[model samples]
Target: MYPFVRMFYQAWKNRNAPKLGLFESHHSRHVCMPWDIDLWLELNNGRTLTIFDLGRVPMSIRNGTAKVAKDGGYSMAVAGASVRYRRRVTTFQTVDMVTTPIGFDDKFLYIEQSMWDQTGECCNHILLRGAVIKKRKLVPPKELFDLMDPTLESPELPAWVQNWIAADDTRPWPPTR
Candidate 1:
């Protein structure tokens, strides 16, 4: 009877672990852990992962930029993503960042994000290629294109850049709700 009661008590206490962070162990400070924000936290930072997240797809689906839509707005489902790490980043290492919307075509949207260390060193980067589907088809409807093209078919990017995130022939986006 004593053993059963102790086991139940331990389980009950373990259920409410706010006193502990996700990876924090007993007596851990739980202060340096990172948050997986915007789904970009492929690293340990307490901030949201914006650019590598849906920033590219949303930018492509809405327009050549990550600019918010003017009408009722739009949502994008990421067809796929790929990231190539150039270097390692330790905890709390701050870096300068930049993002550029190269362009989009047919059923694919392409974007690139760069990260630079405090010393202006190129720390790492991610190349993203995604797709937009309105009804589970590769053919983007008039409304999607209408929303995308307001001024130019594609935006201009800086020189000295080349790595691109292109789409695979397979795996289309889920239909927009």
Candidate 2:
């Protein structure tokens, strides 16, 4: 089940947070609950992605994208992601999560997120490609930005992220063994 309550709480908690520009980071804090752990007694890999929602949604809200999405009758979806887990988070361990919009191409927006342990070490990081949907069609990032804030233009995507996207494009769909 989705953690709607926690998501709502995060939205409310950050309601007064300073508005962010396109390239600014949105910082949020979270803890590893019992349910978030796996049989190995650490935060589950899948749960990490789910928990990332807690940060990303609030980031959209803080940056005014959520409001624009709602008003425009659009929704955002994650199209692709690459993640790296470097450390284990045990039960009750607190982590500071940071989310930022790296940039967008014509079709997709790229977001970078990271979870840092209490001692300021990065535990995990993820790069996600997202698309906005409107009337069953994918809305280009430029169009979405025009609707949200015309003055705000997407920054250039980093070279590494562009490389990843290129690599993904080369992979054939419908795997053949």
Candidate 3:
């Protein structure tokens, strides 16, 4: 089951956070419960992604993207993502998550996120390509950014992200079995 209760708690907890600029970072903390673990007694990979959502959504709220989308009747979705898991997060251990907008292109907006364990070691990192939706069609990121702030100009996407984007484009859709 999706953690609806935790989602609500995060929203309520960060409601008064300062508004963030388009490229600024949003930080939050979370703990790994027994339910978040896998057979190895460490944070499950899938749940780690969900935890990243806990960071990103509240981030969108603090950065004003969520409000702009709501007011404009648009919604957001992750078009693609790549994650790297490097360390274990045992039960009851807390981690700090940092999420930031890296940049955007004509098609999608890119965001980078990472989770740091109590020891300050980065346990995992992910880069996501997100799309804004309206009428079941994708909305260009610039349009949404314009709604948030006309003065917003996307910073140049990092080379690593650019490479990943280009590489993803080469993969056949409906990938062959």
The RMSD (Cα, Å) of candidate 3 is 0.8
Candidate 2 residue lDDT tens string, 1-177 = 777888999999999999987778999999899989999999999999999999999999888988988998889999999999999999999999999999998899999999999999999999999998999899898887898778877777889999999999999986787
Model 1 scores a TM of 0.49
User: Over the stretch 1-64, how does candidate 1's per-residue lDDT look in tens digits?
Assistant: 1133323443344344443211122210111124422244344332323423422332233223
Model 3 bad stretches (over 4 Å): none
Instruction: Score every model by TM-score.
Output: 0.49, 0.96, 0.97
Pick out the ten consecutive residues of candidate 3 with the lowest summed lDDT: 144-153
Top candidate (TM-score):
3
Q: List the residue pairs that clash in candidate 1.
A: none
For model 2, the stretches where C-alpha displacement exceeds 4 angstroms are: none
Clashes in each model (backbone N, CA, C under 3 Å)?
0, 0, 0
Ranking by TM-score: 3, 2, 1
Error of 3 at 106 (Å): 0.7
